[model samples]
Structure formats: structure tokens, C-alpha cells
Target: MSTSFAAESALASPADGTARTVIRSAADVSQLVNRGAAVGSDARIVIAIALGGVFLDAYDLGALAFGVKDIAREFSLTPAATGFVASAITFGAIIGAFLGGYLTDKIGRYRVFMADMFFFVVAAIACGLAPNAWVLGGARFVMGLGVGIDLPVAMAFLAEFSRLNGRGNKAARIAMWCPTWYAAISVSYLLVLALYALLPASHSSWLWRLTLGFGALPALVIIAIRSRYISESPVWAANQGDLRGAAQILKRSYGMDVEVDAAALRDTKAPVHKATWSNYGALLRGVYLRRTVLATVIAVASSFAYNAVAFGLPVIISSFLAQSMLTTILASLALNLCFAFVGGLIAVRAVPKVGAWKLTVLGYAFQLAALIGLAVVGRPAGGAQVALAIGFLAVFLLGQGFGPGSHSMTFASLSYPTSLRGVGVGFNQTLMRASSTVSLFLFPVLSAALGTKVFWIIAFAPLAGLVALLAIRWEPSGYDVDAEDFDAAKRT
Candidate 1:
């Protein structure tokens, strides 16, 4: 678990003394990346654009949070219909993650990354223009598809483009998705607030449409600049026996001017694992099984609790305080920015030092305590009680930001090597989205039936996460997982 930025001798020119750095195999490219990017390289820009995709996923997923009630009222819907509309996007994400994961590995990260942005544009427009419940639900499901597909590719870009461990290591970059996600959620809240204030009293219902539609703006921005800044992962290219293509990408993106070693090129072997349906099964077998199980549990638990509380924050706040829409909006925005967002930033800095495991455990503990306090307090009746209730909510979110929120992706993305990275994230997200669908669809029904007692049920999620972490004791931060790809190649 050491951190360094020096390139290995494997990337040095051969004894014959050629001017260019020589790449003999995929391992050479991986070693170069593990050593860290060259100063002022375009690699950082590629990571930023990849993070833009994560921003879109968060924006679209949370955009509907405040709007769910309006959607239910406009469609004159029952509870079940409202749930369907609310949960449709997650359902779409479930399917999209499964396919997107395989496709990211089967094709290349660049192709998958470029394609999902269009899904956001088309689906956002469709949701805004929908005339009926069915159309709105359908549009959301399509948007969910984009959200689902984007994560696997985005995580892959962050991990592959980053060094193994250091200031901007793989774990830290992957954990960045956490803050970017909260930042997107905060932006959505700000949009909702702006629309709430600006719209005429008679036209206030238009607030939801405008908020949801604004999602396309960032997607379009990413699309326009993608070709200039983004390129296929050099390590992935070398893994595919394309040393020449890999060398070109290294020069363009990594600022490393290297050449394919002619003698080594002649002896290059095929990649150990080709993209195929059977790779999904590989997740459940041998060494991967334990890591896969641990990552899946972490993701499912995190998604279930987060989707229930974060997505339903407005409703929960309004219920506890019985406040006006304006008050609820301001309160939600403040709690997220002050607690959750800041917590994510802390996790990003702390992971490379304390590691993902200890922080996640601490986070789950905070959430567990917060949930129990909320259940015990029920709906606040007095000033002191109300303050306590809000404090509990803040504690829960703070825990989320630093713990599972930041590191769930850490566990999911870093547990496997480049060869299996796509499928690894895909499988984790697929199950995670399923948990989200269940939570989103059931929250209204359960809250209505059980009221504040619902916190008791929600508490189980973090509890399960704690149990899994304790059982596995696996830490992903600062680990050199990409070496697995090269090691498997050597074995074959």
C-alpha cells in the first residue's frame, strides 16, 4: 500500500537505445498508468468529462424527487400508479446496467461513453413534453437507461485513466463520483427553487417540467467536447493486442511518447479474457466471488437507504416539520450542501489515508444511529424535538457522504482489473438499481402505512452493510488491482 509517481524501467527504451519509450506488453501500459499521469496531460480532462456523466446520472435520478407529487396529481393517479411513475427510471436502469456493462467491455469505453449521452437528451425532452402519465413514466424509464449505462463506463474511465495509489489515485477518483453526485442533486434542488420563485402562481405547475428538462444542457456540453478530450484507454488497447493504437493514445492522452517494441509485438498474445456473456458467470466463481459478493452487498444496501431518504427528503422534511414548500426546499438544500456534500469531499481525501473500509464502517454507524433516533423521535412536536429530528437527518446524510456514499463505487470499481472492470461495475449497478427501484416504489406505500415507523425498516439496510463489511474485511483503496489482468495474461 505504497504511493509513488515514478515510471518503471519496463517502459524504458530497449538496450539498442531507441529514443522512444518501449512498450513490450499490456503490463507495460498498466505500469505506466500506475506510476501516475504526466504533468499537464490531457488525462485529467478525460477524467473530468467522465465525471460529467456521473453528474448527469445524479441530476436525472434526483430531478423527479420533488416532482413526484406533482406528477401524481397531474395524472390523477393512485398510489400504485404514482409508484410506477416514480420507479420507472430505476427499472430502466436495471436493464441498462446489465447490457451497458457487457457492452463497455465488449466494445470500448469511448464508444459506450459517447452513446449514453444521447439517451439523456432524448429522454429529458420526452419527459418534459409528455402529455400523460404513461408518457412521463416511459420517458423516465428511458432516462434511467442512460443513468444505468453511464456509470459502468464512467467508473471504468476513472479507474483506468488514474494511477494505482496517490493524491489522485484510482480509489480517490472513483470516490469523486460521490461528491459529483451530491453536487448534481444540489443543482437540481436549486433549479427547483428558482422555478418555484419565478413561475406565476397560476403557472407554478410548470416547475417540474422545466427542472427535468434542464438535464440535457450538461449532456450536450459533454457531447460537444468529447472527441477532443476523450480517447480509448491505452491499457485496454494494449490488452487487445493493439500496441500501435495503444502507443498513439499514450502520446496523445498520457503525454508519454512511446513506441511498440517490434520484437515484443511479434510475440504478443491475445488478451486473457475476451468480452462475452460468460464473463458474468466469472463474477460468481473462484477469487472474484467473495469480492463480487461484498461489492454487491455494499451497493444494494447503499442504494436502498439513499434512494429512500435522499429522493424522499422533501416529503420527509415537509412531514416532520409540516412546513411550506419554500421552507422544505431551503431546508433540503442546506442539509445536502452543508452535510452530505461536505462529507463526500472528506471521504475523497480520507480514503487514500484511512482507506475505504474504516470510513464505510463509521458512516454506517452514523446512519444506524440517525435512523434509530428518527424512529424514536417520530414527527417532531416542539422546537427542541424539531431540532433533534433535523440533526438526525443531517447525521444520516453526513454518514452517507463519507461512508457508503463515497466508497460504494470504490469497492465496486476497484475490486476487479481492467479486463473485468466493465462487467464488475455493471453487475454491482444492476443489483443496486434493483434495490433503488424497490425503495423508490415502496417508500410512499410504506411511509403511508407505517409512518415514522418506516425508519425502523430503512435502518436494516445500513445494518446489513455493516455486517457484510465486518464479515469480508476487504479494503480496495490504494490496491493495485489492474495487475490481475497482466498476471492472468502471463498465466495463459
Candidate 2:
């Protein structure tokens, strides 16, 4: 229960001449994780699985992008109804994030994670076979819940499983979500393309359903293997005053042979921060308020711009550039893979060295400039002008890959320790999903009404993100935020 107890119990060798790490408290478990996992440890596999969850989030969110029009035609939906169907998932994500955040902290990461996979598999199948617009919308909403719930826990795994600092540090691991997200989006685009080619012209209308249904494949794969590779977060267990449970998790997940001290097991003190509704308010008070504000703004802005541009990308290309559907798909796919995905990769590799703040700033600048260029160019009449418009769109996505895209979650996850990580990311995602709902609903209407001028409105997103980053100047990379939990525990 004391600091000296933790220090003394940090390590020990058994009488049989084998080394066994001693975990006496939450701090001890944190120390082991902070020191990084052993090579080829299950900890790395856990991180990979967490990223797979992220892949699902991106895939489901984007799978419907190209098929909205088909859905509209098939369902005989009005523009307003179409908007509702498109935005329903985000609405579900909004509610899911709020609840999932609390549940993740209250129930534990493993339970929330394992349970959300069912949401994806079931919802995806329902979406594919829905009989009407209402059914499709409901199914998509369920899928959105899975996406919402997955992010907070996925981020927790990434942040907790990796070391506090280094090439693959917490910041870097968290930032990797950006590239993984883009990769998932690219994969969805590829799927659409493949289905488009394979499906006969007579059955082309089935494209959306088939694409959405495919989401179940990955979720089921993750579910089957989860029991083998996934384990409860050791720090969460220790925080609950279950040192024995924490030690076991370390042995299985981190490949560390650890034993809980008898005295530590006997000490049944309450955790530093019990999972409570009040913790949500804590994000807006005292030290966390500014961080919450900055992270929320960055997330909202990123979501708005991305949902508006990326989700509507096929439409923009087909209508604005006057291109065919095939051309639109290929262009969108190439742009995402070559620019957005590549940029995300750069951000992941560079964040550890260059810092998240600098890259985010540079990324926002690129987005802002690109948006302005698109606004100025308007609808391109000539071939060169068309190329320029596409170039601007590519630039905007490229900026997104590295800047707010990669670091928004970085700020959200690392700004809080394990105690508040779930709620922190949950709160951030809740607002971000709300923004997505608005953007997804409005982009079609706005584009129809304003034409290319909509780029000017979209330009505001990155600009806001840039302003927030400059004003706040809080960088999450390389920071030892987990120490806060121990400091608070000591105070109690």
C-alpha cells in the first residue's frame, strides 16, 4: 500500500534459482509495461489485434460511401431519407461512444472488446439483407455501435501494451491508428472495385449489400483468435486492487514471469478513480479541460472534413469531373492509397522523432491550402483544371493522413492515464461522431445546392484544427501520463 512496498516488490528471484518479476500494485504493473514487452511477446499480438479492430471501424464506416446512390434508388428514398440512412451509423456511434467509454472503464477492456465484435458481425449481415431503408439504417446503426465501442478499447490496448517511449512508443502506437484507418478505407474501396467488376451488369445493384456483408468476415476472424491472444489490461486489473490477476495477465500477455506479493493481495484499497458518470465531468475541469477541448476540436474537425470529402469522394469525382463510375472508383482508390495511406505511414514513422505537434501543424496547413485551391478552381471545364481539382483533393487527404488524422487519437489516448483513458477517448469520439453525422447528412445537400463552393465551407475544418493546435500547444508524444495514476494513488 505504500511507495516503499511498491519499490521493494518490484522484482524478486524464487528459491529455485528462476527470476520472477514481483507486481505489488498498480504502479508495479505500470512499471513493467513502461519498460516495454519482451521480444515476440503476446503483447505485440495484442496490439495487432487492436489495430484489426480499428480496421473494422474504418471499413464499416466507409463501405457505404460509393453505394449511397444505389441505396437511394433501390429504396425510392428522398434526399432527406437518404441522409438519415447515411447518418444513422454516426448517430449510433455517438450513443455508443458515450456508453462504451463508461462501460470500457467500468467493465474492463477485454469484455467490451470481445462483445463489440458481435455487433459488427450481426449488424453487417443484417445490413446486407435489409428489406427496406429503415432496416438498412437500423443495421448500419448497429454496425456504428461496434465502430464506436471498438476505438476506445483499441486505443487503450495500443497505449497500454506498448512502452511509454521509444520508436514504438505509446504516441507512435496510437498514431498508427491513422494509417490503419486509411488502410481499411483503401481495402473497402478495393472490395467495391472488385465487386463492381465481378457482379454482372444485371446484378450491379447488389454491390452495396455484398460489400457491407463482407465486414462480417474480418470480425469473425478476430473473434475466433481473440481468446488466444487477448488478455485483460494488467494495469486495469492492478488498479482494481487485483494484483494477483494483474500478475497473471503479465505472465500470459507480456511473457513476463511475475508473482503478486502476499501483502499487496491482502490490501484491498479502492481504485484511484472508480468508473463513474462523474469522471466524464472531470475531463472538462481542472488540468484535463484544455486537453479535452483541444482533442475534441481536433477530432470534430477531422471527422467533419473527412466524412464530407472522403465519404462523398465518388460523387465529387463522377459529378464534378464528369467521369464514369469506373473512373471515379479507380481515382478514389489511387488517391487514398498513394496519398492518404502513404501520408499516414509517414506520420506514424515520423511522430516518434518529429513530435505530434509539428506534424499536425504541417498537416493542417496542407489541408487548408488544398481546400482553398479547390474552392478557387471550382468545377473544372478543361482537362488540366480537372487534374488540378483532383490534385487538391489528394493534397487535403494527404494532410489528413499525417496531421489531425494521426494525432487526434494520440492526444485523446495519451493525455489521460489508464484510469481515464476509456472515458477520455469515448468523450472525444462522441463529439467526433456527432460532427460526422452532421457532415455526412449535409455534404450531399450542400454540394447539390452550392456546387464546388462547398469546398470553402469544408475549408473551415482544418483551419479550426490548426488554430486549436497553435493556441493550446500540448503535445502528447513521449509524455509519461501513466505516472499520474500512481501520483494520485500515493496522495490517497
Candidate 3:
């Protein structure tokens, strides 16, 4: 099978040129990565490195959840200012997602990968050393840039590198982002707990600083090893007419030895893709329009609900259980790691089996149920309140981890061609981050005003998502990249 597959992709020459080379299309690249022998060690390491960036993104974003209260206290922030501090990164993320998507497509994935890490390093340092709310918010916004930029490139690499068959394909690879995100969230909680326990009262101010600053360490590690381990996406390079460069990377990265014809390269007939502002409208037209809408709906809905609940979990739990700061931190850690992390793992496994549509629907259902439960239970006093609050919150996080939480990015990443994948994801993420920014900013205000009724209000986000998912039913799993309308448009 291996020999036949390789022979099928062996060297060839076109009518226009005499040179012979492997006649690899975007489809062939998909097959080779998905079903070929190259899907072993290199694939795993590449997935790890790319997903490692995901881990850091999650860590940096979530680290603030536990630290928000401490920051409010230390900086003497008003409620509105506290919301701004909590949501500052999200505001920056909106900008990052828009610009990063364009830059990723215009420049290249490798360059973006190398460049975005420093955003984390510098921003994390600034956040740790910030002396005022304004400075802290500014630093968080910068960190958001790193978080926002890394996602499109990382997801693109994962999809491009993965095969379409067997256990871990495109959907699976993208779904891994969820668990890695939860893992990072879990790590942040563990770090906060350890710091909270270790730090004396005199030096307790260092908890949030250390928690926020610690995110940089992983980014630095990713930077150190990324250049050595990661390779440029061959599909992307090939699409750009760099047959030799693509061939070299293929040979080196996946250990595939294939001949190349410099003369037979770059289909002159294939349309050149020069991205412009007008292209954003293309996502709203034809088949891409449907996908773009579905992805946006899911991403935005998920971001809205998750940010409102997950980022504010610490505060919500404290209020619900009427617990001290220490108790709240410990409880948040336990629930995040136990429920959210578990749900993420379930999602990773379920993605290949349940399919994106069913899994996402189930996830939304879980979230809906959890929200109702919270609203019904309201604020109770005593151990029953503790039990019910944890139970409902666990269900909410679990539903999220399994459903829209992970697949939002998965849908965005896989729904477009290499030419548009970055932008597609960027656009989806931009809207999603914008939604996140709004939700995070509003959650505190709403919670204060409406109390537990906030859960009922937030539940509507998932309901909307569920309706969109059931209506669209766009399953991106095992989708053929070459078949995207964008590619079809390019030829015509």
C-alpha cells in the first residue's frame, strides 16, 4: 500500500515543461499526510509543538481568571475597571485575530510561528511588573496579541500536517486544541494554588504576578524548540509555487523523498490569490458563506458563554458558596481540572466517533442543562449549595469542553483552503474574541445586577449556537481542502 501510494505520487512532467517531478496536488498532500507512512513520529512532534502553543494561549488567557480578584484588590480597581482589566487581553485579541489572520496568509505560517512567541515573552514580563491598572491592562492587551496570532498558524499547521484517515485526523488534531487548552487552564489553577499556599501574607501580592508571568516560560520553551522541530507547511509552500522549497521541506520534515521539476512547477493557469479587504466578503458568499456563518455562530456563541462563566468562575463560586478567597481558589482549581479537563479529553476521543455535529449538539445540550440548573439552584446556604453549585458548574464546563469549546476552532481551521484557512480562522476568531471581550466585560456587571439570573441569560448563547448547528449541519471532518469553493474560484 505504501509503495503504491508513493508510486501514485511519483515524479511526472506537465505538457508545458520537460522537467519531471512528483505531481502532488493539495489533495495529494492531504492523502500523504493523512494516510502515508509519514504520519508517525514527525506528525506527533509537529502536533505537540503546534498544540503546545495552544497550551500557552490557554494558560495566558485563563491565568487571569484566578488573578482578577487579586488584581482588583492590589490596583484598587472599580468594578468597571476590573472588568476592563479582565477583558483587556480579549480586546487586543480581536485586533490580533484580524491582523494576524491577514499576516499569516500574506507572509507564511513559519514566520508567524517564530514571531508570535515573543509577544508572549515580553507581554508576560510587562504584566508581572505592571505598577498600575492602566499598565496591567496595556500589558494584557499585548499578551492577547500573542494569543490571537498563535492560534491561526498553529491550527493551520495541525490541519495541514494531519492525514484524513484513521484515529487522529484533521478533526481529531484540531479537537486536541480543546484538551490542550484545558490542560493549560488546569496548570494555571495548580500554579495559583501552589503560589497561594507557599506565599506568606507579607508577600501575597506576588501570586497574580507570578501566575501571569509564568505563562512566558512555556512560550520561551516553544520558541527554543520550534525552529529546530517545526517545518513550513508544504501545502502552503506548494500553493505559492515554491515547488523546490516545498519538495525540500517534504523530504526533510516527513522523510518523503520525491523528485521535483522546477520547469513543471506552479500551474501558470491557476489564479493568483492576492488577499484584499474585499475577500472578507467572499466568506459570506457561496458555500464559504454558509461555513463562515456557521463557524462564526459557533465560535462567537461558545466564546460568549465560556468567557462569562469560565473566566468568572472564581468569583461566581465564591459568591454562590459564600466562601473565602482561599477556598474559592482551591474549588476553582478542582472543578477546572476535574470537570473541564475531563470533558476536553472526552471531546478529543469523541471527535473522531461522534462527529462534529452530534458532539457539538450534545455539548450545547449539556451547557443548556447546566445553566438551567444554576438558575434553579440560585444562591443557597450550607453544604447543599456547595454540592449543587459544583455539580452544575461541572456540567457547564464539561459540556463546554466536549461541545463548542473545542470544535469552534476546529470548524474554522478546516473549512477553507490553505489560501483562506488563515484568514477564515482569523475572521472567525476575530468575531469570537470580540464576543469574548464583550462577555468578559459584561459578566461582572450583569452578575452584580441580575445575580444567578445571569446564567439563564448566558444560556441563550448556547441555545442560539445549537439552533445554528442543527440548521447548518456542516461537518468539516475529513473535508477535502482542494474541494473548497475558494480553490474552485481560483481556477475559474
- How big is the RMSD of model 3? 4.2
Between 1 and 3, whose TM-score is larger? 1
Q: What C-alpha lDDT does candidate 3 achieve relative to the native structure? A: 0.81
Task: Give the alpha carbon lDDT tens digit for every residue of 1-492 in model 2.
Answer: 334335334354546777777666688888889888887689989999999999999999899888998999999999889988987888888988988998889989999999999999999999999999999999999988988999999999999998977889888899899989989998998999999999999998999999999999999999999989999998888887777888888888988888877877677674555689888988887778889999999999988998889888888888766768888889889999999889888888899899998999999899999989998999898989988999999999999998889998999998888888999999999999989888877888899899999989999999999999989989889887877787755222
lDDT for 424 in candidate 2 is 96
After superposition, the stretches of candidate 1 with alpha carbons farther than 4 Å from their true spots are: 1-7, 10-19, 268-272, 489-492
Query: After superposition, which runs of candidate 2 have C-alpha atoms over 4 Å from their true positions?
Result: 1-16, 270-272, 489-492
Best-performing candidate as measured by TM-score: 2
**Clash numbers, per candidate:** 0, 0, 3
RMSD of 1: 3.0
Candidate 3 lDDT over 1-492, as tens digits, reads 111222263443465454332633444444455564353446578778999889988999988876776889998899889878887888888888888888777878889988999999999999999999999999999999988898989998888877775578788889999989988888988888898889998998899999999988988998888867788887777667665677777677777765654434645764345556666677777778888989999998999999899888888887877768778878887888788778888877878777888889999999999999988888866787768878999999999988898799888988787778888888998999989878877887899899988889999999999999988989988766544522465322
Clash pairs, model 1 backbone: none
Question: Which ranking of candidates, highest lDDT first?
Answer: 1, 2, 3
